[model samples]
Target: MSQSDHDCLFCAIVTGERRGHIVSADDAAVAFLDSRPLFKGHVLVVPVRHVETLTDLPHTRVGSFFGRVQDITSAVERGLQAAGTFVAMNNRVSQSVPHLHVHVVPRQRKDGLRGFFWPRTSYGSDAEADDYAARVRDAL
Candidate 1:
């Protein structure tokens, strides 16, 4: 553990310094029920290490970390008998906690939550869309 780990809420949960309704855990990651859920059975999957953001996570650890997330996605859907699920991650913006975590939210038709967390918008024109795509591709 590092200095940052001691300050991270999720790290405390992983190390048993704090309480979390843990659903799953292994060498790679730990998963738990969200205290404030979008719906019942919503789960948060996080790496065991104190990674602050997805971009900060090592490439070598990515597959193993997300593998745990994938397994929990299945378990949450099956265990809750949900129609489906909404999985998401906020890297830094809108991320209440700094530690990297994936949200697995159970979903059903007409379950109140709609579209997503924000309103939809369009690029206005094909040229505008192409410009945005080109910028992203260039960055890649």
Candidate 2:
């Protein structure tokens, strides 16, 4: 792909061409809040380099990318006081952004955030959504 390409949403975010609620950033990668979150405090971490999927990235970069994910997960847990966290990556079938990225989802005991195998329901209302955001922000 051309260096100027912005078709990839993660590339846009990394280059500041698209707006994102960024949580953390560095020379190599960035972490941002997921707009369509499965739960509160959900974050998406991506490398600055534009790679279509995990296998597309260099093996060395993969280690660093996941290292950043771990850091983000720790921050999310401390920031949200989350009971636990679930981290995952998608390749061809599950990939949404068509860029290598990892999802760090915060889970709570009563929130019914089971593993990835479990289905998720949408927030009941705007108020509920706001409440969830506030709770996670408070922890942050």
Candidate 3:
């Protein structure tokens, strides 16, 4: 997308027009803790310029966008002490927000996440969410 969508939630967060548990940001992408996380330290990485879906992302931005996703995946694992991570993206159908974003969830063996059936949990409080955001941000 050439410009930010005024009504897009991710765009609002990316532009600092809305509050988000922001973890990291740069020219190419932004990373933040998912309000409803599959696990603590779950992060959503999105292109700085709002693109509704992966197919809409410019070919030139694909590598850098995903490189940031890769970095967030590692950060989630290191910061949360997860065994690994569940990294995924959905197109228009299951996409919660219209903007393109990749979910990088901290995972451990037997954490009970199965397939696409994600069971979400909250940070319980703003301070808790801030703590999680801080840990990942420090790792980044």
The TM-score values for the models, in the order shown, are: 0.97, 0.78, 0.80
* Colliding residue pairs in candidate 1: none
lDDT: worst 10-residue window of model 2: 1-10
| Model 1 per-residue lDDT tens digits across residues 1-140 | 79867789999999999999999999999999999998989999999989889999999999999999899999888988888899999989999999999999999889998867898899999999999999999999
Candidate closer to the true structure by lDDT (higher is better), 1 or 2: 1
| lDDT per residue as tens, model 3, 1-140 | 33548789999999898999999999999999999998888899999998889989999999999899988888888888999998999999899999999999989898899867767888889999999999999997
TM-score of 3: 0.80
Q: How does candidate 2 score on lDDT?
A: 0.86
Prediction 2 TM-score vs. true? 0.78
User: What's the C-alpha lDDT at position 132 in model 1?
Assistant: 99
Worst 10 residues of 3 by lDDT: 1-10
lDDT of 2 by residue, 37-118 (tens): 9987899999888888777888878778778888999999999999788888889887877888889999888787555675
Ranking by lDDT: 1, 3, 2
The number of clashing residue pairs in each candidate reads 0, 2, 0
